[model samples]
Target: MFRFEKYNIADWFSFYRILAVPLLLAFVWYGERTLFTWFLLVSYSTDAIDGFLARKLKIVSARGSQLDSVGDQITLIMGLIGLIVFEIAFMKANYGLILLAFIPYILQMIIAFVIYGKTTAFHTYLAKTSALLQGVFILWLLFFGPVYWLFYTMIIIGILETIEEISLIYMYPHWVKDVKGIFWALKDDRRTIRKKTVKKNGV
Candidate 1:
């Protein structure tokens, strides 16, 4: 996964978030709320930066998509850990909703991996929105306090995004990357094209 020879600028940006995970955890371990929140902010910023650079430079690839997804999952898990440790009261208050939203997401991962042998890179608009809301909600809670509306919005968007991903998995029947959403998936050539072979006349 850490192929220095093949990594582009955008991939490195995604890698930054992954590398920051331990630092974020260290801050959490030390009970450095301010430091943890600030470092976590950097991680979220890279999430946006990597995606923008990938699109602007036309350097997107399946590997890049997978790297970005892994970075995202790790960052989010770390962020949740930070939240649980630093904001124990808030997390306890909302544990049920958090767990409820996570179940479908976990199930989606299981189904996708079982069928596609890897994580889905759908990158659908809904997924992007969900990530955005999640980052915002988590950061807001850490920096300020709990905002019920934002929390609720993030939960709803997350569930919807996970459902869309599961649906796309069934639609493609194989791995694909950078899909915009369900509408685009319906028209994706990857889903429609069939393999063909041409034999030499001598054969």
Candidate 2:
């Protein structure tokens, strides 16, 4: 049902992330840490490239937004797997904080699904920064080892972003494709438009 009218270059880049999951998994299975790190870096890079391309080309659409969100989630999961597999000691040391950070995020996901059925694709500015930090931290750890300062910063921003996303989900009556953040969401008229579309499309 999530058909795209046409796939743009940005969509293709996102699609690459989805399609790369198996390759990434294979790397993990084979314990190819170096290869996996390089590939994960590429997958993370695509996230930035797709967003930039979509904005530059003005090819953004609900379908593209959904695709990008899916790609982002997939890449994040794969990267996390890499982190656990390769940096077991670090993850063990910081497992408590990681679990703590995930609590609100997990609840946020539940809240979104219960209210909206699917995850919100708000793509807030805070989320972008959090994602950038995640990628940087993962790559930095894999390449040069963990930096506690960066790890702590990433956790803080990530939790903050999750809170912002949850707030946006409740602020809007229906799923929104994009939002700047809580501040802009305050005055975002796009909510009305998205609500109408959701009602019409039953999405």
Candidate 3:
């Protein structure tokens, strides 16, 4: 997973977020909310940049997809930690609501791990939209405290994205990456191609 020689520019961009985790945590530990927010913004920006580079530069790969997914998960988790630490009162006030939205997400992760032994890298359209909403909400909360409308939007989109992920997990018996959405998943040849290859080899 840490094979540096195999990584491309987009992969490196994804890797940067993982590297930034400690710095983000230190900002929280030192009680530097503004600095943490700015750095977190950078992390969020990289998420967009890496995907653009991956598609534009045509550097997409299974390993790159996995790396990007890991980076996204780490950055988001750190962002949440930063929020809880710096915005304790706000988080506490909305803890139950947050957990209610998060339960399906947790279940989605469990389903992916059970099916693929790791988090998925489907990167569907809904998932991308959900990530955008999450970043917007996080930045808004950090810069302007909690906003109810943004919070509601983020939660709703998140639940939808998690449902889509769960469906994709069940749809693809083997792991896949970069599926656009359910419609695209329905037509994907990855599973059938693998089955054909296996049968061809009598495996």
lDDT of 1: 0.89
The better candidate by lDDT, 1 or 2, is 2
Clashing pairs in 2: none
Q: Give per-model TM-scores.
A: 0.92, 0.91, 0.92
Query: If the candidates were sorted by their TM-score against the true structure, best first, what order would they fall in?
Result: 3, 1, 2
Candidate 2 lDDT by residue in tens digits, 81-193? 99899999999999999987778888988998999888778898899999999999999999999998999999999999998988898889767788989889877888667
Q: Looking at model 2, which ten-residue stretch has the lowest summed lDDT?
A: 1-10
Per-residue alpha-carbon lDDT of model 1 for 84-142, expressed as tens digits? 99899988888899998999999999998899898888889999999999999999999
Task: Name the weakest run of 10 consecutive residues (lDDT summed) in model 3.
Answer: 190-199
Between the candidate structures 1 and 2, which one is better when assessed by TM-score? 1
The true-versus-predicted C-alpha distance at residue 132 of model 3, in Å, is 0.4
Output the lDDT of residue 39, model 2.
Answer: 96
